[model samples]
Target: MGQGDAPERTRRALAAAFDPVFYRTVYDDIARTGSDPLRHYAGTGWREGRDPAPWFSAAAYLSRYPEAAGGDPFLHYLDRGWRQGCEPAPSAHRERFLERIGARPHAVGAGPQAAPRAPDADLPAGLGRKAARELAATGFDAAYYLSAWPDVAAAGQDPLDHFLQTGWREGRDPSPDFSAADYLEVNPDVAAAGVNPFLHWLAAGRAEGRPLRFELGFRGRIVARLTPLEERVAAAAR
Candidate 1:
């Protein structure tokens, strides 16, 4: 084959390997636009809020033939069209593209096995896996402690540890605070009452079963969201 024929051959090979379902979905567009399906998808498939089929189909294609993908298949496909003289648009989809292909941002830690659990690990046992995943994605660690020991968790010390050591002492409310340490300094009444704020919050606040206010980090900004533990439990049940 001539040097110039190699890209066309590779393109043909990729077309033969394309998923049938994906082909049918975009076939009309391909025919109408007179474009190669693989190149078309390489340019447009892995976008957020679009149909996931194109992304998944591209992933399935790579998974079926590992050699074509080399060391990093997603990146390989991402740059393939551009390398063949297509415009450089795929780079813009880097984040979503990596996500679609299940690539991790960092290598998995090989440290101690008994390392401290992520805050989401403390999620109530009743929460279903889906709900737990959603909460974790939203960074709702405070809710776990709020449901378990509102005042103590709000007070900022480890809720379980503080509860075990001090028990319920009076005047220990970490009132209207961000961290347990902060609450301790500010809430003089709780300090004088000498009660375990953790236990007190559990009995008085948690028992009432109010929705917990927590911050959610979305799209690089923090937004407030209210969540009741019972709602999560119900979602789990469903």
Candidate 2:
């Protein structure tokens, strides 16, 4: 979302990182009979298109290496290529490439963590004892029953399911369907301080006390302000 030219800069950077090998293998090879050594690589499997360079803007490259332009001769060439090639392009291929490459889950980078292993459906004996004792005083409330289940709720859906089905629940209001940002295609406002249309929709829904459906989806700024209803319910139980 930054500069429109940023993506091209990034693409050139990728090309530069790989350029040293690219130039040597495709351009400077003495064994080749023709002037275009790069043409040979392109004719073979090394180059992907009419462009003489290899494709480094893909997630496959990042997935195998676990870093953006892993520190190497190839990476150095890629960085330089990104700087040189992206200057002329006005469109946003670089940012799209970054997003695609960055989306892979990894513990090391800013990416999301690898999926956690599924927890045992039955609670451990000690955890079950602790949960039972914690809820002993608050008799017959599903919300109370849920309080002892922080570990499970942190796991997300399991607790949601248990809360929905269990009787005597105190907090029954469903958390609004703010996940709709995944569905809607909307444009951003031009003003620097403009309120996002998505946030306006969420506020309008909150004012009406109507649950947001999955399609209308929230833009997240409101979601941040509204304490997750689960935390509120959990606090009330305590």
What TM-score should be assigned to candidate 1? 0.18
- Candidate 1 wrong stretches, greater than 4 Å: 23-39, 46-238
**Candidate 2 on 1-238: residue-level lDDT in tens?**
4688876864554333232333344333323644444334324423332122233333344334444333332233244423333211211233332233342223455545544433422222233434543432222343533465564456564443454334113323222323223212121110111222223333342454433332212223335567788999999999
TM-scores of all candidate predictions against the true structure: 0.18, 0.16
What lDDT would each prediction earn against the true structure? 0.40, 0.35
Tens digit of per-residue lDDT, candidate 1, span 71-189: 33434443353233222122323344343334323346756564565433333435544554443333224445456566675677764344334422333322233244333333323
lDDT of 1 at 123: 31
lDDT of 1: 0.40
